[model samples]
Target: MIDLLKEWIINIASLVLFITAVEMLLPDNSLKKYSKFVLGLILMTVLINPIIKIFNRNFNISVYSQNISRSIYDEDTAKSIEKYKEESLKNTINNFENNLTQIIGEKLKEEFNLSNNKLEVKAEYVTQESKFEIKYIKVGINSGKVQKVEKVKVNIGEKNIEEKDKLHDDIKSYLSKELKVQEKIITIYKL
Candidate 1:
């Protein structure tokens, strides 16, 4: 170690002397500035050589570079995985809503005899419970369309008016029971 220190000092001294000599010989021109910059770099390298040697004894450049690349690749892969998860979740929610709407439309036609209708289901995933929750449902039906003909011997005018009002409540109650949600979350409108 003592011999290495002595050699390092000698190398630094020689580099400094050479730099001084070169600076003195160069004329005052554009090249003088460039030469001085190069000499300064050489001086810095010589001065730092011993410290570099000591630290570099155990340092493997290839292994260090590989580790760096691996970390970067891992970060990129994690981001891609997160993005994929978000897209998959979005698609799942959309498909669930569409299928539910189709089922609701079919049921309305079969049970209520109402064909001209539009259904919108609002739902979201509850992260805390790890389940999906229905937020609200809106059903639009045209009143002028054909409805279920119930055969009851009563005043037809009053019965028809009563049926029109009761239809909204009945639809809301039906959807509430079928969806397992509160009655208030379902809304029916005559379009």
Candidate 2:
């Protein structure tokens, strides 16, 4: 074993010396550093080659890798962790949106002079880079059996916003401040 190790060490030293000589002979350029790095990697592989050979027949690499992987991530535990993450994310976003809609409902009550109990608050989520993102807020005003207003005609409303629109500007500024997002990403609606 000592003779084998000594021979391996000699071989590695010779290879490194040869690589160094070759690199010194080459012209300095943008690729010189990269070439040196590759040569270093080659020397490392040569140094480790014999050590790997020493263990070649003694251990089963496939089984060892399987056991290590299992220890790192058990199937059931991985599944459960993924599920927990999804649920927690969903719950947190839902609670935030619920609170947001409630606030909007109060604001709507103030804006439209509606009673507290009649506004149905809901939110619509639009897809961003991820699966779901808050895009539009819908506040349903259900003034049940109000004298003349219930009979008034209602029309479908468009949500296009211009820079001159004060309500959109106000709401956009408010949301941008409160939610810490750009106004361009949010839209509000009343139904």
Candidate 3:
């Protein structure tokens, strides 16, 4: 142990002297500015590396690098998984909304005897205690034209839109009562 201590002291002293000699030989230039910082970092690594290895028998460069790479990989994997989950959730919500709109369109067509209709439904919802509740739902509907006698349109132009809009009071009344939503959120147009 005594010999080891002496050897360590001698090694450190020689390293310090060598660094000083190198610094004296190098010109004070832009290159030296960058090189000195690099040199100092290398010196610190050299100074501590042997000490670390001596105290920690299990320490190795390959193991340290592998651990660093593994941690980075884990972080990247976690990030990708989160991204995928977010994308899937967004797609699911979009699909649900689209399907809801389709169902609403079908029900309206069946009741009103319309052949084709476009229905857009918007809703404001909130989650409380992991339970979802809708605050308000807005509905916008338009009639489409199909070139057949069986396919009939409610109102096709601006002139008919104004006339047809007033005729949807029964529909609005039904939706307001059935869905338990506000009357202001429901809009039906025949255009």
| Best by the lDDT measure | 1
- Candidate lDDT scores, in order, read 0.81, 0.65, 0.66
Query: Which candidate ranks first by TM-score, i.e. highest?
Result: 1
Task: Give the per-residue lDDT digits (tens) of candidate 1, residues 6-30.
Answer: 9989998888888889999999999
Off by over 4 Å in 2: 1-69, 106-132, 142-145, 149-191
Evaluation by lDDT, superior candidate among 2 and 3? 3
Q: Candidate 1 has what TM-score?
A: 0.53
Q: What TM-score does structure 2 among the candidates reach?
A: 0.38
Q: What are the TM-scores, per candidate, against the unseen true structure? A: 0.53, 0.38, 0.43
Clashing residue pairs in candidate 3 (N, C-alpha, C atoms within 3 angstroms):
none
Q: What residue runs in model 3 are displaced by over 4 Å at the alpha carbon?
A: 1-73, 123-166
Off by over 4 Å in 1: 1-73, 144-164
What is candidate 2's lDDT per residue for 5-117, written digit by digit as tens? 89988988899789979888889997888888888888887776677778785655457769999898988889999999879777877876778767766655676454443
Summarize candidate 3's per-residue lDDT along 109-168 as a digit string, tens digits. Answer: 777665455566643334355422333444444445543454555765555232344547
Query: Model 1, residue 162: displacement in angstroms?
Result: 16
